[model samples]
Target: MSQTTLRRKFAAGLTALATAAGLVVGAPALVGAQATEQGSSASLGSAGSAGSAGSGDAPNTAPAFQPAAGNENPVGFRNWLRPGCSWDPVASWVQLCDVWSPAMNRHIKVQVQPARFGGNAGLYLLDGLRARDDWNAWTRDAQAQRIFLQDNITLVMPVGGQVSFYTDWDRPINLGGNLVEYKYETFLTAELPGYLQQHFGVRTDNNAIAGLSMGGSAAATLAARHRDQFKQVSVFSGYMNPTAPGMYTMIPLAMFDQCKCDPFAMWGLPGSPRWGQNDPLLNADKLRDIPMYITAGSAIPGRYDQPSSLQAVFNTFNGIILEGLSRGSTIAFQNTLNARPNQATFDYRTTGIHGWGYWNDDLIAARSAQILPVMNAQAW
Candidate 1:
C-alpha cells in the first residue's frame, strides 16, 4: 500500500480499536486528550508481575562471590566512590557501589552484569518513567540478566528516577508531596560514565544505550547529545519529539497525572529553547553518525497479553492509548530522520501495546539487529 494510504488505515484502525477498547469516553478527541485522564500511570502499577518471569527462565549462573585480593581497584582510584560495592545474590552480578550524584544529591544504584570475557564495551539499559528504586525494570520485569548472560559486554542499569525522564531538570518537581532532585542527565552522561569507565572498565567509544518509554527518549537524547560517548541507541515506545504540537501539553499532563511531577521543572515552560534543544527530532542532525534502532507498536493487543481482570482490562486500555501516542510520535521522528542523510532501523509493529512484553521484544530486536553487530565489530 502507498505510504499515505497506510497511514490513513493505521489511524482508522487505531480509532476503531480505541472505541472498541472503551477508550472513547466522548466524541473521539486527540489520542493525547483521551490519555490525559487515564495517563501513563498504569505503568506505575503491578502490570508486569504476570510477565516478570521474562522470556528466559534460566537460573542464575554467577559463581559464588569471593572478595578481591588486597583491595586492588579494578581501574584505579576514583572520587565518585562514596558508597562502595556489594554482592547481589539474586542476580549473581557484583552490585558496583551506588555512587552519590552531586547533581541529584542522592545515592543512585548502578548494577553491572560483568562481561563473560571481561570485555569493556558496555550496554546501558535505561528504565521507563515509573522507574523503581529497588531494581531496574529490565532485571525485574524483562529478565535482561538471563538474556545477556553470554554476551561479552557489561550490562549497566541505573536505579531510581520515577518521572525524571533521565534528563537534567531545570528544577525539582513536587511529587507525592516530596521534591525530587532530577539531575539525571548530568548523573548518567557525565557522573555515571566517568565512574563506570574507571571502575567497571566500560569504554566511552564502544557503549550502546537503549531505554523503554521515558528511558527510550533519554537514550535518544543522550546519544545525540554525546555522540562521542554512545555509538548506538535504541528507543522503544518513546515520545521522540517532545516539542511536537500536542506534546508540549500532553507530556506535562501525563507527568503530573502519573507522578504529580511538573514538566515545567524538567525543561521549562512550553516553547522554551530547552525543549527544542532536548527534543530528539529537532536535534536529529547530531545523531546522524550514530546507529539507531527505534520501535513502537500500533496499540493492538498482542499474543503475549491477556486481560484477566477489570484492572487488567483498564490497564490494557490505557496502554493502548499511550502506545498509540508513542507510535504517532515515533513515526513523525522517523519521517524527519529519513529526510536527512541519516536513517534509523524503524520497526513499526502491526500489533502490541505499551508494556514489558513489547519493550522486551524490542530490546532483543535492537540487540540482534543493531547493537550486537556493532559491538561484535568493535570486539574484533
Candidate 2:
C-alpha cells in the first residue's frame, strides 16, 4: 500500500438500501447457468420483508426466516451440504477462513474453507461491515453454493470487517498504523498471489470474487483498480458510489465518524476539484474490460416511529431512506454502471431492496454473466 492519495473524483457516499427480502419483486427466473454445490437454496426466504443487506444475510449468509420442511427447496437443499460435524466453519473443511495481507502487507483476505468434496480455485466472497464475525453464513451459504463447484476453486473470505475495503488504506485509524506504511498493497498484489499458488496450487488464471452491498462496491473497485489480478468481478445491489448524494450519511457521520476523518479528507469533497477521484463512476472505463455483474433493488419505506434509545439517529435513518436512499443510491449505482458504455458482460437490475433473500436470490438469477465462470470452470 502506498501513501499516495487516490487522485480521482467521486460522488457522495451512496445511500444504503434495505435488504431485498423487503422489496417488491414478481420473481425473476434463475439465470441460464446452475452452479454446483452441496445444499439447495436456489431461492428461499420471506418475500416483501424489509431488512439490511450486509447487516444480515447477504452472500455467504443464511435466510433470516425459513419455510416449512417440505417446502425447503432452497434452505433444506443447502442444509444437506452442511458438514455433518458441528464443525460448520467452512474454513475448516479444506483451507477454511485464512487471513491474508499480514505477512506481505497485501490488502486481500481469503476465506478458503476446506471442501469436504475436494476442489481447486476458490470463491472470493466479500461481506458487509455488519457481517465481520458470522462464520455460519460463510460456512453454510458459501459452502452450500459450492456444491456447484467441483472443488476446483477456493472460497476466499477475508475477515477484518471495518478496515478492509479489500484495498490499501492511505492512513491509519485511531491507533492502528498505516497499512500503506506497512506495505499492505504489496502483499495483496504480490505476496498473496504467490501464497495461493504455494498453498492451494491455484493457477490464478480466473479466480473470482463476488459480493453483496458494500462488498459489491469493493469487488468492482478492486477489479477496476487491479484489473490484471481478477478474471471476473460481480456486485449485487452495491452502494457503488461512496460519495453519491446523501450517501455518506451513514459513514463518518455515523459508523466511522468517531475516527475523525473520511474519504472527503482522504481525497476531497464534491466540487473540491478532487471529487469523484477513485470513484467507481470515474473508473467505469477500467471496469468495462472485465466481466461484471451488477444489480440493485428498489428500497421501500418502513416503520420509523418505533421507540428507541437513539431516536434521533433512528429518525435520521428513516429520513435518509425515505428521502435519500429510496432514490439516491440507485442514481449513484446506475450512474457508475452507465459509465461502461459498451458492456460485453454486465448485469444491472432492480427487482427488490438489499436483503439476504433477494440478494441471495438475485445471485441465483443473475448468474448468466456474474460468477458462473469460476463455478463452471471447475463444475460443482
Best by lDDT: 1
TM-score to native of every candidate shown: 0.79, 0.60
How would you encode candidate 2's per-residue C-alpha lDDT over 1-380 as one tens digit per residue? Answer: 11111110111122223222232222121111122211111111111111222222122233432212332122221222221122234422333334355543444334454322334454566665334334424334433344333333455665444423445444443424343323333555566566665555545554676776556666777777676677777776565566654444433342232122353343334444333544566667787666666665444422322223232223223322322232345355556656556453444333333344445655555444455564455233
Candidate 2, residue 331: how far the Cα is off, in Å: 4.9
Native-structure RMSD, model 2:
11.7
* Model 1 ranges with Cα > 4 A deviation: 1-83, 92-96, 377-380
lDDT of 1 by residue, 1-380 (tens): 34344333433444554454345433233322322222223432223323333312111111222322332223322212233667654454536568889987888888777665567788989987767677787776675666665566778899878777788888877877877688888888888888877776788677999998888888999998888789889998888888876666566655654565555888899999999988898888888778899998887778655766444555566567667778877888888888867747889998987877677777777877988787772222
Count steric clashes of candidate 2. 68
Q: In model 2, where do residues sit more than 4 Å from their true spots?
A: 1-61, 64-94, 97-109, 114-120, 131-137, 140-151, 175-187, 248-250, 257-277, 301-341, 344-351, 366-369, 374-380
Task: Give the Å error, residue 182, model 2.
Answer: 8.9
Q: What are the C-alpha RMSDs, in order, of all predicted structures?
A: 8.9, 11.7
